[model samples]
Target: MKILKLSYFVKLSIFLILPFLCFGQEKEQKEKPELDLGGALRFNYIYSSWKEEQKTKGGEFGYDMFRINAKASYKGIFLNAEYRLYSEAFGGGFLKQGWIGYKFNEKNQFHVGLVYVPFGIKQYNSHNWFFNITYYVGLEDDHDMGFKYLHEDEKWEYAFAFLKNAEELNFGGDTENNSSRYSYDVVGRNKETNQFNAKIVRKLGDSIQHRIGFSGQYGSLYNIDTNKNGNHYALALHYELNWNKWNLKTEIITVSHSPENKEGQSNKIIKMGAYGAPYEIAADFNMYTIGLSKKISVAWGPVSEIEVYNDFGYMQKKEKEFTDSFMNVTGLLLTAGQVYTYIDYAAGYNHSWLGGNFEDDFSTGNPDANWEARFNINIGYYF
Candidate 1:
């Protein structure tokens, strides 16, 4: 009789507290946040037609970069960041992008910190590894210290941002803006400031889709020497099409800058820098770009898919005395599990990163510049 009474008492105690225990577990699960961390390692092989020695040696292979990506979310708050490490000759190591955001609902959100400028096409404007000519001019994939508000629905998307300045390298009190960064910015005596951007996109169709977008930007150019602010503005119109396994992109952009520089300095040219170097770019220009791509699925071993693309870009300077710049890239992308590779044949005329000298290629380009070509292969492993 005593043993039966003891067993009954224990069973009654567990039954009385079981509901509270279940409730607490459910609440804890709901409060827990989600986190994801990932990274990539990449390498490159190059055979430049302009580099005689490299071409004679059958090209060169080297380490490209290593990068880390992190993301976290709790309730309606989220964080995202990426950091990259490159060779010392490049920009060394730097934070690519980082932002904290809050979602009010499914269609509205706010972001702060270093955010991408809402300009041009979304994400990348080109399918090739070299991107388009707009990237070198700081009009594509550019990021700044800013706050952004975004709204999206089934057929429309809109974004507005106000950027105080570009990302600063905080070394010391007299730290000068340098080219040790991932994106191009005004890095000499002048800095970008008080920039505002607005963008809207209209989406149409489902299986065969079309997207049309318009973007506008205006910013102040703060010259340290003059201590007076100048102004710059850009306008862009872009279109994208997706039909089955084929995609197409095209854009037209016009940009102009009026900077308050020191005496005797040319206002038609501005100093822009990135990847450990500075170069001059024309202050007023028009750019045009177009790209087409087709995707194919494959059953080859360790290779699941392939995409073939061709991208072309042209820049025309407002100053008639200055020459023009153009680039064309034919490439294919291969994806297999965690590995991705790009094989590209790129040709350019008066392009900065191709073969022309960096100082004036994008400013007063060389009229006698001949076409230069580079065959490159880049492979990356992602986790």
Candidate 2:
């Protein structure tokens, strides 16, 4: 019965889209050659292997996520939507991201609607259609819901943005009691984040460049005991200097936040969980990371890159004492809350349109969890 209902819905959606597809085709036939109306298709494939530890047993698991994206624009207004079909190996697939936007100026000005946050490296590609694995939107934490601004010229370029809780995923009912086990509430944390961000870039000669950026979010998290306030602020800096065949790149990030537990358990974590647990409380936390990367072209025409990084961090925890078992601390917590060290090393081949992103190894678990690696190859054409 469920499958029947789903099939009916899909048919209805296709029916609704038929008119727009036909209309677009008719417009193209009637318009001048200068009027542009077309869209591109993109494919993404991802695979991961995981190691699990449990008292009874331990084993390995893997999953794959694939996405197909389509986009179209007419004049300054545009629309983009994607369909994700997951294999049975990964449960199933569905639409991942879909939104629309408008271009504001000759320099790529834009006002996006339900669009992907336009504040990342993905916007610029040598192929004009492919993106690097690292080119992710900050708002990827959720669906981008808001506006964007961009400015580009010879010496200076910049981007600014705002996004809401547009792509939150909530599954099933009775979320308050069953969220952790079987449900994914779009606003699972029961919080709405209002984000404001900015990026500025400066060009210095042919071998040197610099970029600085900042992002902030303010919101509230709904917990059982009390409504907790939350906020996140981050600052970023990037610099690159090239000498002959070698290039030096440095990136830095400073982040601060105050978040709460949805189950209202901060107090227990502070008191009985661990001595330094207090620092891990749902209060306030701050961390900073700096990384230096070097890239050199090898005799094989492939570029090799290496990065060394570290994070220094601290936090202020929340306190609570309650008689209920549910309110009591139940797990091991480490306080004194200090990051002694963090680092990662990666060496890989470089190609156009696709590559990989290297991340520091903090190790909650899994070596690859601390980083991401991939091989990408794509093709694109413009008319």
Candidate 3:
């Protein structure tokens, strides 16, 4: 097995600097530390058009996952972590996010550890169970091992982060990039490293709230076989509008990756993985997404409210020879006390998770690939 070599100096620096920043605050009013623990159990039922036998049998229902969430705060320091347990088929178990943060004041805060990359939308780009295509391309809700600084006020918010790499599964010895994890990242013979990101959002209006934001990121792609580094960059413009009970979200993103691969490997595609699988994706592409949701109060038994939504995404590969990808999901979210459920009809063409084959869906997709659909319901109870 090849040895994995990480930049120890950078890791050491972060560990050394965080303690000083977290503890150096002048002693003010002493507040008691607080800790909160919560978790959720979820299940899914799916009927897929591509699965002939399953469709003939009606559908399949099974346990989806259970997850634990922890939050602790003391004075100006805080910690947040989440761990998920999935079936063996879905990457088993992994740490979804864990971070330690320090609040300098009301407007400034710093975070270190496996932190979310501030890009595009804030928490989620879509209201549906299946996120937009940007999630597959590692642009939406992606997290990395990094340090981040955030500043927010009434009208403006800003975030800057320096990410060292994707969260590493193996500490020092193993060379293979593990695919058993959440969130897509460069895998195979290449790894993501030395990434930097910046995001700024401007808030406008009160009742009819509007938010406009810009995000940019640049990172390095380290090829183990070639012993060389390539590069990647992405830029996005996003907008969010909320008026009364109606909400809208939209974003346009352009991403490019230039990987220094072995002589025979094609530069047009790179490998990315999540949930125990790795697949090739076009190295250069543009993505567009838009979603709208409206909430309605309900008097049905045990159901308090329902959110109806539609989310659509389009992926346009930069290379003319590669076929593009499309996805659309129409869904409803029902909330009743501590239980929530999602019912969705999702359709896609050349999408990795939707219906296309893993090998070529996001790569050089077949020109004649037909659209496929899935009807799914997920129910989860939280405490």
Weakest 10 consecutive residues of candidate 1 by summed lDDT? 169-178
Pick by TM-score: 1 or 2, better one? 1
lDDT of 3 at 368: 88
Tens-digit lDDT track for model 3 on 234-340? Answer: 99999999998999999999999999999999999999988888889999999999999999999899999999999999999999999999999999999999999
The alpha-carbon RMSD values of the candidates against the true structure, listed in the order shown, are 3.4, 17.6, 12.9
Using alpha carbons, what is the TM-score of model 1? 0.93
* Residue range 1-383, candidate 2, lDDT tens digits: 99999999999999999999999999877653332343333232222212123212432223223345566667667767665544443335444456666677777777555544433222321111112112211221233556777788777777777766444345323243211111111223334346676767775666554443333344333333345655555554554444443334333434344446555433222110100111111222222222222333334322132222221111112222211000000111111112111121122222111122211111011222222222222222211
- The lDDT per prediction is 0.92, 0.36, 0.92
lDDT of 1 by residue, 106-161 (tens): 99999998998899898889998888888899987988889999999999999999
Q: C-alpha displacement of 154 in model 2, angstroms? A: 2.2
Candidate 2 matches the true fold with a TM-score of 0.48
Better of 1 and 2 by lDDT: 1
Q: After superposition, how far is residue 106 of candidate 2 from its true place, in Å?
A: 1.8
